[model samples]
Every structure is written in structure tokens, then in C-alpha cells.
Target: MSSFFSRLKQGLSRSRDSLAQLVPGGSVDALSEEEWLDIEDGLIMADCGGELSGSLVQQARKRRGSSIEALKTSMLSMIPDAKEINTSENGPFVLLVVGVNGTGKTTTIGKLATMFGQQGKSVLVGAGDTFRAAAVDQLAVWVERAGADMVRQHDGADPASVAFDTVQRGVARNYDVVIVDTAGRVQTDRGLMDELAKVRRVISKAFPGAPHEVWQVVDGGTGQNAVVQVEKFREVAGTTGLIVTKLDGSGKGGIVLQLSHTYGLPIRYVGVGETLEDLMPFNAEAFITSLLPEHAVKS
Candidate 1:
């Protein structure tokens, strides 16, 4: 296996082991009613929502074949195909990223810069999360490591202004891509959500149709809560995609399925480890293979 796939398998070991223990050893045709229930329960235990787990179990039961193959088919059908970010616009491609605090939002931005840098694209990052001084400092460190430029203001400065400046600078400097980071706020805070909306508007004003994409970074280990974050952020920021993080050693990998089933938004990337290269572009086949037995697809 390639290094990324190997790391993904290792990262999902906990979730995979939990699922393997629940799957019946023999063929699906021989599965008892209790065994069918066991499969559903296992999915729930892995943080796939109860409704989705039931639906997947029902679909799998209808497909009579190898147990692992049938279950994998059911899951792959639920998740949409992975898609790359749209960066083909005329000027610099701008991306606005938002999420709750402690979800590794800033770290994800840093990794994004590194990824774009490796592509031979110049990256300019905006430290829009000005409420926290540490966030700015942390992003600065990541920007330098990635060899990317950044625009920031003092702590407590207007985040929208910072975003505006970043986009303006990106245009002026002719950077290939500009990524703007937002303050992590609770989903329930209407004021904060309004502020986030303003940031998006300012980015657009700075560059028409800018912020080509708004991606939300979510913690895979947060289970069902991740769903709520996506919903709220999508409402205010018009989130275009997702970047899931903290999957390493997090047995809750099934949350990815739940999110996909819930929103149907493209999963742009997944963070399986702490290293810069651990952020792998979403691969549907590889994800399923890592999370379950690598049985051939049943016709």
C-alpha cells in the first residue's frame, strides 16, 4: 500500500477492529436475525447515526453475498464520490474556512497551505481568527513552515477587515491561492454566526465572486455533534465542502459516513495523522478499504 493508504489503515484500526468483531464470520446468507442486529449496533457504536445505520443494515441484508462485500457495497453507495477543490478561476482562488474551537481548524489551514505549496502554487493565508492571539501565532508558524505568506491584525481586530486585506493582497501580489481562516465559534451563537457571514461578504467585496469555496473543518471524534456544526456553518458561510480531522487513533471514523449521508456535501480532505502529509485528499475506495475488509466488489 502507498504511505497515505497505510497511514489511513493504521489510523482507522480502532474503528475497523470494532466493526470486524461485530460482522458475522460466515456468509451473509447464513446470518441469523441476531447477527443482522449486531451489524446495525456496531455501526451505531462507531458513530454512524442510528437512522443511517438501520438503512445500511437493511440494504446489506437485501444483497446476499460475502458479508464484508455486501456491507461495503451498502456503505459506498451512501457516500458521494470525492471531489477536488475548484481552483480554476481567472484570478487567485480564495477559500474561506470556518469551524468550532478545538476542532483543529487552524492546523487544517496550515496543512492546506503546505499542500498548495507542494503543488508549486503560491499561497497567501489570512489569520482572520483575530480573537485569539495564540491562533494567529500558531498560523504564523504553520505559514512559515509551508513557505506561504500571511496577513494578520492585532488580537480583537475586525476579522472581516483582515479577510478583506488578505484577498486584496492576494490579488495585488498575484498569489495562486488565498485561504482565510475564521474564528471558531459555537454554533448556537447567532452573533458569532452573523460575524462569520460578514467575513464572507467582505471577502467577496474585496474580490468579486471570491472565496470561491467555503470549507468547514470538523473533528471526526466529535460524533453526532459534527453534524450540527456542518449545518450551522453551512447556513451562515454557505459551506461548500468539509475537511475532517483528528481521525488518527480516533475510533469514531464512521462519523464520515454519517456526515456524508446527512449533508451530501463533498468531503474535500481527511486528516489521518499529525504530519503535514497526513492530510490526504478524500478517496472513496481507499476510505472504504481501510475501514473494512478489502473484499472485491460483488456484481
Candidate 2:
């Protein structure tokens, strides 16, 4: 496998191993009601949604067998396929990122820009998070590190205006990618969400079918609250995909499965560590297998 895929496998293996230790395996046929409850509790503790955990356990009960292998296979199958980005387009690929404060939206943008730059694609960043001077400065640091171009207005400027000018520059300069970082706010803020939608509208108007991706960045450590955030953001900005941050810090990586199965939003990327190269593409099979017991892998 490619190095990226291999690193992803390694990171997910760590998470899965941690989860398996929380609920030791026994023959599926011999699982007592108490043991099943323990299994369900383990899934929830791992940040898996209760509904999803219940459903997975129900399916496993129906397919119960003498070996743990059968249970592992069934559990792995419960996870849906990971989503892939469509980089096939010609012009600058614009990604509009949204999320609440402390979700690592700015950091995620910087990492994404670095990844695109490594591919030799020219990138431009829009400091659309005009509400915070710190956010603007953070993105500027990323621009320097990634060696990508950037557009910014003074803090407190209209964010939509910043977005408009950024895309206009991208089209004129013919940059390969344009990433706009928006102000982080709770999804409950109707005015803020409307403003985000307005920014999307502005970008689409400038370049039809542009703002190609609306990615919501959620904190993996937020647990079930992340699911609520996804739903609210999707309704507001029409989020096409998700980038879950801080997976290394939280045992709640299982929220990914719930987000995918609940909202049908493909998890395009996951943040395992803080470095620019730490951001990796999501792989469903590898992630599922990582959650299995080490003995399960050998058997």
C-alpha cells in the first residue's frame, strides 16, 4: 500500500486496539446478556452512537457464531464505504470550511493546503474568518509554510466580501486550489449560518459549480455532540463532506461511523496528529480492521 494508506492503517490500528481492550471477546454463541451489555457499553464509550451501537449488536446477534471471527466480520461490515474527493475538475478547487470554535478548522485548512501543495498544485487561502484577527494570522502562517498564495481583508470586514475577492483572484491567477476559512460559530446561530450560505452563494455566482466542496470540520472528542453539529451545519451550508479533527486525542473516533450512516456525509479526511502531514484520507476497511483484536487479525 502507499505510505499515506499505511500511516492511516497504523493510526486506526491504535484506536481499534484501544477499543478492543475495553470489551474482551468470547465465542458469539456463548455471549451472555451481561456480556452483550458490556459490548454495547464499550461501543458507546468509544464514541459510537447508541442507536448505531444497538443496531450493530442486533445484527451481530442474528449472525452469532462459534468464533469471534464471525462477529468481527459482521461488525466491520457495518461501517459504510469511505468517501473520495473528485479532483477531476479543471479550475481551482475551492473548499469552504465551517465549524464551531476549537474544532480546529483553521489548522485543518492549513494541512489541506500543504497536502495540495505537495502535489505541485498552486493553492490560495482566503482569510474569510474576518471575525478573529488570530484566525487570520493563523492562516497566514500556514500560507507561508505551505508556500501558497493568500487573500485577506482587515479583521471585522464582511466575510462574504473576502470570499468573493478570493475566488475572483483564484480565477484570474488560475490557482489550482482555493481554500476559504470561515468564522467558527455554533450552528444554532441563524444569522451566522445564513452568512455562511451567502458566502457559498457568492462563490458559486463568481464561478458556477465552484466552492466545489463544503466541508464541515468537527472535533472527534466532541462525541455525540458532533453528530448534532453535523446535522445543523448540513442544513445551513449544505455540507458535502466532513473532516473530523483530534482523533488522536479522543477515544470517540466511532462518531465517524455514526456521522456517515446518519447523514450520508462521506468522511473524506481525519486528523490523527497536529502536524501538517498528520491529516490523512479516510479508509473504511482499514479503520474497521484496526478496531478488531490483534488475535482476531491473526486468526
Candidate 3:
């Protein structure tokens, strides 16, 4: 296995162990009703939503294969295929990132800027999280480390204005990419969500059809709560994709399946560790292999 895959498997070990106990080496035809029920329960306990777990178990039981192989196929079919972030044919490619507080939204932006820079693309970041000076300061450190440019305003300034300025600068300066970071908000707060909507609108106003992608960064350890966050963010922010972070040693990795199966949104990336290299582009096969036990029943 590649080093990144090794890290992914280790990060998801806790979640895998939760399901492994219920799916020992066995033929699917040999599983008793109680054993099948246990497997479904195991999926639920791993944080796959209850309904999805039942559906996966039903599919697995009806499919002809080793118990583990059937489960893997069922899960792989549920998640939508990963989609690449859009790039503009002309002008800067813009990305708007959103998430609840403490979900590592800022850090994900930093890693993305680095990824783009490594591709020899010029990057500009907008520190639109102006509610906290410390937030901009945190982002500044990462921007400098990535050798990217940034735009920010005084604390309490309108976040939408900051985003507009960033896009305007990116356009006029001929930068290759622009990434805008918004203040973290609780999904239940209507006022804050409205501000987030305004930010998106302002970016489009600055450059027509800009903010090409709205990606939400979610904490992998949040379990079912991550589901609710994604639903709310999609409603107000037009979240097009997901970046799941903090999966290193998090038992709640099963939330990835639940989110994908429920919303059919592509999971763009997963953060398996703290390094710049840990923000891995999402791979369906690697994710499933890391999540499920090997097919132990001999052919």
C-alpha cells in the first residue's frame, strides 16, 4: 500500500474495528438472521445513519459473495463519484469554503493554497472571517507559509466586502486562483447564515459566475451532527462538495458514508493527519478498503 493509504487505514482503524467484529470470515449465505442483524447494528454503531445501514445490510445479504466483499460493493455504490473542483477557462478559479466553528476550515484553506502553489498556480486568499482578529492572524501565517497573497479587513467589517475585494484583486492582478474563507457559523443561526449567503452573492457580483465552488469542511468526529451541518450549509451556502478533517484516529469515520449516501454529494478530500500531505484527494476504492475488512473467505 502507498504511504497515504497506510495513513488512511490507520486513521480509520477504530471505525473498521467496530464493524469487523460482526463480519468475521464467512460466506454471505451462511450468516443467520441474528448475525445479519448484528452486522447492521455494527454499521449503525460506526455512525452510518440507521436507515442507510439497514439498506446496506439488505443489499449485502442478497448479493452473492463473501460477507466482506458484498458489504464493500454495497457501500461503494452508495457514495457519489468524486468530482474535481472547477477551473475557469479564463481568469482566476475561485473557491469559497464554509464550515461550523472548530471544524478546521481555515487550516483546510491553507492546505489548498499550498496544493495550488505547488502546481505553479498563483494563489490569493481572502480572510473574510473578520469577526475575530485572531482568525485573520491564523490565516496570515498559513498564507505566508504557502507564499500566497491575502486580503483582509478590520475586525467587525462586513465579510461580504472582504470577499468582493479578494475577487476584484484576483481579477485585476491576473492571479490564477482565489480562495475565500468565511467566518464559522452555527447552522441554526439564521442571521449568520444570511451573512454567508451575502458573501456568496458578493463574490458573484465582483466577478460573474465566480466563487466557482463552495466546499464545506466538516469534522469527521462529529458523527450524525455532521449530517445536520451539511444539510443546513447546503441550504444557505450552496455547498457543492465536502472536505472531512480530523479523521486521524477518529472512530466516527463512518459519517463519510452516511453523508455521501444521504446527500449524494462528492467528498473531495479527507484530512488524515496534520501535515500538508495529509489532505488526501478522495478515492472511492481506497476509502472502502480502509473502512472495511479484507475479504477473508477463500475463493
Give the number of the best model, judged by lDDT.
Answer: 3
Per-residue lDDT of candidate 3, residues 1-299 (tens digit)? 49979988887888787777776567889888888888888788888889999999999989987888899999998998866678898899999999988999898999999999999999999999898788899999999999999998888999999999999999999999999999998999999999999999999999999889999999999898899999999999998999999987567777888998898899999988888988998998899899887644232
Q: TM-scores across all candidates?
A: 0.96, 0.90, 0.96
List, residue by residue over 88-167, the lDDT tens digit for candidate 1.
46789999999999999999999999989999999999999998999999999999999999999988999999999999
Q: Model 3 compared with the native: what TM-score?
A: 0.96
Mark the regions of model 2 whose C-alpha exceeds 4 Å error after superposition: 1-18, 64-72, 82-84, 87-90, 295-299
Q: When superposed on Cα atoms, how far off is each prediction in RMSD?
A: 2.6, 2.8, 1.9
Task: Output the TM-score of candidate 2.
Answer: 0.90
What's the lDDT for candidate 2? Answer: 0.79
Answer with 1 or 2, whichever has the higher lDDT: 1
Error of 1 at 39 (Å): 0.2
Q: Over 4 Å off in model 3, which ranges?
A: 295-299
TM-score of 1: 0.96
Model 2 per-residue lDDT tens digits across residues 170-222: 98899999998899967888899899889999998878887888999999888
Give candidate 1 regions above 4 Å deviation.
Answer: 293-299
